[model samples]
Target chain A: MYENLPALKKPRVAVFELASCAGCQLQILNLEDELVDVLQLIEFAYFKEAMSNTSEDYDLALIEGAVTRASDEQKLLEIREKAAIVGTIGSCAYPVGIPGLKNSGDVEAASELVYGAKAALFPSVPVKPVDAVIDVDFHVLGCPIEKDEFLHTLTALLIGKKPPIPPYSVCVECRMKENVCAFDRGETCLGAVTRAGCGALCPTYGSRCYGCRGPADDPNEPSLEALLEKRGKTPEQIAADYALYNGYREGTAGRREAPDG
Target chain B: MFDRVIGKSDLTDSLDNLAERYRVVAPVSEGTRYRFAEIDGARDLDEGYIPTALPPTKYLRPPRENLITFAWDDEIQVEPVFDQSDFILFGVRPCDLHAIRLLDEIFDREKDDGHYQARRLGASIIGVECLEPCDEHCFCHAMGTLEAAAGFDLLLTDAGDGYYVRVGTDKGRQLLTELSGAREAVYEDRRRLRKIHARRDQAFEPRLDVEGSQIPALLADSNDSLLWDVLGEKCLSCGACTNACPTCFCFDVLDDLGLDLKSGTRYRTWDSCQLEEFAMVGTGESFRQPRDMRVKHRFNHKGRYLVERYGMPGCVGCGRCGRDCLVGIDPIGVFNQLKGQPVERR
Candidate 1:
């Protein structure tokens, strides 16, 4: 038998969060069966929600959630500094996400609904994704995130390779899935403009994609906007729809910076 | 080829006889759409059904098929796997039937596909004539694929009380022996089928601006057609059109390993030209860079390239691509615009 060389060091991975729901972080855990195999290949360093033994020294940093508050920005910078590889998970950390939709008008009213008069306690600004606040070495994009994609990103870093990025819009994925057209059903879809990789999930179930995965590699918003208009959609309605996850790229998120915590 | 007057009861018997010998596939409704699926009896047949969302070619070239199997433990070993089954594709519309013929040209080129040829030769085709246009979207008449004279073992024409069966191959002739009550088609039955076809011809008013013969020339001159940009801006590039398209046979190959890692398989999965990375090579160069260019290529391939290469039509006018485009960038509308013919303004 070969002498047991000091066990090959497993790549240290840390999962971090900022100013949004931990949906993206949840996707890693969602890979129930594959999670065990993934765990064997990597060492968990700073996943506070899952592990108590945390470490700053890590190989890869998987950052989730949008950078809305000032405090979240400071924490993200610290995490980015410590990790060798800083990769973002989900739209929240990429360019824009559902949290970015709050960049629209009537924030005081919207905040009041949730925080009441305590809204003053949490003084906030427009939501911007993690990339706006810091550099992201790689991105695993989606609203909640797709599990296999998360694994792909990890494996790519493990082998020092770039993950295969989704090239086209969800319209192509919708076609591949061979679902009936949502437009023909008299419904306007953002699939023609949004990035694929979610495998046209909404459309597969007979619903139009709301751009939950952010803008595709090449998004023709002008053409998409006009098509929506032809379908009797107003400019404001189209803006709001894209704002749901793609407010930054859709050009609906105005000139506002991160929230003051 | 021979003719037989198969009565309604006799036709069912003939189908059952064929079904006994081969795995019979026919159209069946799934919610609002229709698809070709395995049938155990005539009751499973969707008579006068629309063109299925997926074509009979799925049986020949599956969405995913294992091309090779590799086992590596003591030594590396590889073996080619050619999987095929004897099937009778029943109730095939002429448009779909014509698609099979186009595929024959593609697979039987200089590099013959052993996998596709295995299925193609093993399977028998039974075509059902379209007595009328399927819907307002169909342009099979304009595309000249409404009736196929060959590419099928048998052709079935509806005649109310019975079916006028025309056998096109010896395989079809052999099946006739099992048909209990088939008789010689008299002059009256043949005359009725002609009348049905004549009526069908009148119903299919050519929607495309150019005639079927003029398509190759029209496409050559229409390279600068504004229609390509118009369609491109609207395309999702999702590959649904090509995926659902009857004639699209492009595929991607990948290696898959077993959990144990001692054995693995090489498989071919369906690929679409509409995808942005379809033509992208390892060096990071994409030949079809833009959506408009891809759209232009799709139309050109259908209208010009295949015609010039094979001396046959590229599209069979099945309408599945257009039906699933979501943006309404279907061929019938695009072709009219290519020839500078104005679409009927709504």
Candidate 2:
């Protein structure tokens, strides 16, 4: 199918990871059926997850994970310099993701809790999204990266078309499914402000959205905060909810004032 | 109108017989809520149900429907897709019947929506009248959608010992004549129907501050009202309200390419104007960028715009939007405020 789509020269594509669980890269591998078609569209210059081959020369770089260390930042800068286009592959690479939760508390203290006695050996910096250090051509956002969105973005890039990313909130998709609102069940959910494009997967399966894909464009955080407050969510509970993927953004985890309206 | 009477017990058997000929969809209980789902028999039907979570309109305009499928090998080939499934929408409320008529008017206008028109042509509507208000959120009485005169093949009203069935068309008359247990309405049955109607009229109270005729005028030229900002502050812009509405038929079309990339299906999914990107152009210039503006537009579209365009009420006062809204934003509160009337909570 890709053979008929524009008939362009195969670009050298590379996949790189920084300080993530390698889930985003695994999503590429999880493209089991589409992977065959994808392999035919581009030449892999460097993808440690799938191939042993590595090269500095690449036309496109898909980087995943947050930059948590000085070394991670250095590697990202090098990739940005060499690659013609750099796109963040997941919420981790785009919004600092779960790794950014360290920003809500003392970085050293959190590292010591996990890597005690070796905390000094693994000195970590405040988690920053890939765009914080380098320019990002585009983003494929989700927790591990929705495989369909990743493929869609890649296909659009190959054809020189702007990737279609849904700007609406997850509630749009949630309502299409006609699922009972998570709030109706006395549960505070982030679906109201979270980005769509995952087909409202979490809420469809009877789980509240934790904002794994980050905030939608022009997210009504204040309105959501007020709604959560009405549902008896404490300030700490609301902060913890947002801290998962949005802690990197200033005031996102701390803003708990009553809606002025 | 061909008037007939069917006993409550006989109605079940009639519905069972009807299901054999068509896919009969009726309201069924789902946990604490109710939804309009396909039923095999009357056993699966919830006779006493409030407005369903989704209206019977879903059967006509599905949430996601494929518009066309495209394939390119040597040459690009495209084929339009239309839903051809013939089904009977049973147990539809009077408000929803009005909503369906509004959709029919919209889709069957100058530029006919082929998909909607196809489904509508094959679909049969069997409406059930509501004697009482479903909930505090319902304002069908005020909106003048509680009593539907046409748009239905058969209209059923609950009588004391039986159901009063009013046949509106040849299809409805044929259904009544073909059915086993239905008799011509006599003087006693007519008297009972009259008594039921008298009781029904008193059961429902007007829930609007202004008359239904004045709504369009009130909403006209009030585009820049501050009330939108006040409502927007509380509104999450989640679009639950619009999605649950019976008449909100906006959609966004997208292509889903096959793995091979040459073949794809161009599908339309239910979209909402409440979303921030609903009015965004290719150049990134959003007409209704602010949530307040988007919020105002939806109310105007429901009250003024559709009435001005279609000569019919856009909102049927089903109250699904109000009940489904995470924040308790309803038309009753907004309309009362616009009319300078004190907001009353039922």
Candidate 3:
């Protein structure tokens, strides 16, 4: 149904990477059934991670990773200039990903931790999501985006239709499958408070959700926190759980207070 | 017109007489709390009780509902599932009735949610006004949802001996006609109804100090307030509030495969926004990264954004969220905190 995508005109699609593991791009390749269809829709103009091509101008640009170095900043701006619709594909591209954990720490300490003796050789600045540099039209969430969502979003964009954004929490899906509640099972889960996109995979597999997707449209945090506390989780434990994926976002750690005597 | 004066002991016979033809659902004691379930006999009805563990909305909009089913490989085929049941939601509280009204505004606006509309159309609401306050947690008075008004088909007010039924629609009138025990209201019955309403009004004291209309403006101005950071710090992002809220109706749709991956049903289930992944897209970018932003987004949506967009506050002041919250993060308390006023906690 999605046939008249603007990408078909120029058909030049570039996938770039900076400081990420390129796992998100691999996820794009993992759209097994629709991979060939996606390939036909766009020309692989510049994908250093997947292919061995380097073209200047592109119709659609899918960037993965955070801007960590001076060279990476220049490259991202260049990519934004060439592509009409820039889609950021992962936590690294949108919110600095796991690497953003260092944002709270000093550059020197981070450098020391990573480079050790070659501390001076590594980039000194903290990493930032791609949108901080250039405008990103769309974002694909998850540590590694789901295959169906990737293909569906690409297809929707190809046909000039806005992709549907899910507005529910992970708990909704968990209950749908009739799975035992994570809290009842003695494991704290971010499912209730986390956005509903990953189809509640972690909870389904007998693991607590780590909030790989992102936040929902409207989240009920107070109740969720209370539920966790009742289940025996400490305040620090709750803060630590949210800090995993959302450390950069100021409220992710919740309210900070001065220590009382 | 004669005053209806059936003995209190004959309440069950009167209800059983009505149940012979129409499907009846009433409040029944389930564990520590009461719950609304189908009643084959009048004994299932809990006349004087607390609010049900879950609202009657479950009977209308189930937790998991089938949206559309698809079959691929050769030709993409799809079938949309629509609600096709005719049932009665008996003994709904006024707050829940108000909740249904709020839901009607959402599901019936613009595109029209066929699933919700279908279920709503076939169902009838029989409201029972609370003789006494449900509990310390209930704040329906502050939200102005304590009295049954326009949403229900019928409203039943308990008089000394029998119920003074106010028929709100033709269906309600027809249903009441089926109950042979019911008679036309006399002067005394009308006077008693007024007394019951007045007593109920005086009984439910305003629990929260904030004005309902000003909540939107308060939230809009407090967007960047440090309270979010403070609230965020304590928040575990567990999502109990959203789940407990009668008005929080956001959902997620997914395809489930049963052994043979080809044949699966696409079902839509209730989803909360408090979790970290609610706003995450396929590419891994999270729109609301911090717990603070996520928590704030929720309050704003319920208190301000939805009202701005749909002209209605998302909260019905049921107090389920407050009762269920572990850290005592009540919405009223949060609102009061935003206004820089001392909170009146139950």
Candidate 4:
């Protein structure tokens, strides 16, 4: 699949962000070792963080945050119009993430509380993932994108192949690592319903999974609820865990349909 | 004259001596569980450890293995990678030894897997008899894997003060010669070993309702059974069950490119059928979309498919899958339910 890479013209790529901590954009720099060689494979048409040069011409636009304003949606639509493929890079971009916590309560109240008098000037809308506003070709999922997953997605895009995403839950990798189940350790964990490919990062290091990568392919919410209940977690606690990173997702947002390919 | 008995201290000394020349992998304690790891001597060995989370097959067919590496400039050059480093797989329980035997049959079938073959050829197995059932999750007695008759170089039986070492091959006899305390089994030693064997037979009572031979037909006929749905509901599809299973040998191969993009390695990592994507085809159609179908496939493969193909039981009843599963999905419980028998607890 990669054999055709040398023959194809270097694709122009751009990076854009909105309503995020910019931690996801910083993950691009974490590709320290491959950055030099990666530059050889693609041209950065418009990346304000890494390069000053900006261009309207780009083959792909890698967006890295949630759309929380009307202006953000307009910018996304423009990127969708110009780019052949529009991909979201982090939980903020794909699932609306931590910012989506306010979605369950009053968004305007929360906005005013944060910005005070300046809130009216910067007006905040309900947080929505990039896919909610524009057509997204793919998603590199995580709180801040997993660097390896980012590289894999970039390589797949460059090679004209679909980026392979594992459709299993975090529990698979956790169990494979032979780590004691977080629930078994008396900690309520969302690894069972959360998407894998982060190598069960939190659980491996003695912490519970927060589901920052979004829901797994066929997440059985009822099963997860029952599992948590058996571990003495109340309904409110379970909802609280879900709200931390996946509040914006509807019951079946991350669940894949047969035609999703 | 070489002895056929290796005392507890003698075994340790023999292991320490072997460590000088070869990699000796044995079961060692890791936190609350046991895992197969390279040990400098028998001191690191967990002599009475239960079945490890992963079987000794890990050493033969590792979770991630490189098959070939390639580089290109003017022309592409591809070279195969083989792990032929000799190692000793020590402290293998009868169930795991049986698992290794089945893995041998699998990897040796149809175009013999070179990677597995290379590793297998360079490794030696030392089997240890389990005097009692490992835990409630184990049903090795019903599975007929309580004691192994072959597929190991040396067999160790706990004979109170010393170990009764039965040599299975020339390699075993050669290994015995390295131990200074090894001596021919006397009349008393033989009598004691027989008594221990008799007591061991009594300790491992059957946990399954039906015979191991009857599992294939029961599972094959239960294609539309609702038990699968019940299992699917409980199954997280996390693949912990398959990864912990002693006999699962599925793998997915992928090519990893170097920074230069001119060089790369094609590697195969352990894959599980429980994963949703395992059955997905290139055109985006998944054959087993529902979780129940995938759950049923695992039991069918272990109970029916492997039996028909190789005439040997696929699941060795080591109970690692049952013990390691977060949802407590045990094969013995599932099989008994299919047999219209109550779940037995001892």
Rank all candidate structures by their TM-score, best first, as comma-separated numbers.
4, 2, 1, 3
TM-score computed on alpha carbons, candidate 3: 0.59
Residue lDDT tens for model 3, A51-105? 7768887788888887777788898888878777888888777656676666655
Model 3, residue A258: displacement in angstroms?
29
As for DockQ, the candidate ahead, 3 or 4, is 4
The alpha-carbon RMSD over the true interface for every model, in angstroms, is: 3.4, 1.5, 8.2, 1.6
lDDT of 3 by residue, B1-346 (tens): 3234444556567678757766777888744556678888788887776666567887667778898877776877788888867777788888888888888888876549998888888888888788777777877777777866777888877887777777777777666655565667888879878888888788887666678788888888888788887777666555667766677788878665422224557888766677666777886688997877988998888788777877655777777667655456788788778888533332
How close is every model to the real structure, measured as TM-score? 0.87, 0.93, 0.59, 0.93
lDDT for each residue of candidate 1 in A106-180, tens digit (9 for 90 to 100): 667767777998998887766778877776677788878887677655654554455645666887767655466
Name every residue pair that clashes in candidate 2: A1-B260, A1-B262, A2-B260
Q: What is the lDDT of residue B212 in candidate 1?
A: 88
Docking class of 4: medium
Decreasing DockQ order of the candidates? 2, 4, 1, 3
Model 1 agreement with the true structure over B159-199: per-residue lDDT tens digits: 88888889988998876676679898878888888898898
Error of 1 at B272 (Å): 3.3
Between the candidate structures 1 and 4, which one is better when assessed by TM-score?
Answer: 4
Worst 10 residues of 1 chain A by lDDT: A1-10
Q: Which residue pairs does candidate 4 place in steric collision?
A: B3-B183, B3-B184, B4-B183
CA displacement after TM-score superposition, residue B241 of candidate 4 (Å): 1.0
With candidate 1 superimposed using the best TM-score fit, by how many Å does residue A112's alpha carbon deviate from the native? Answer: 4.1
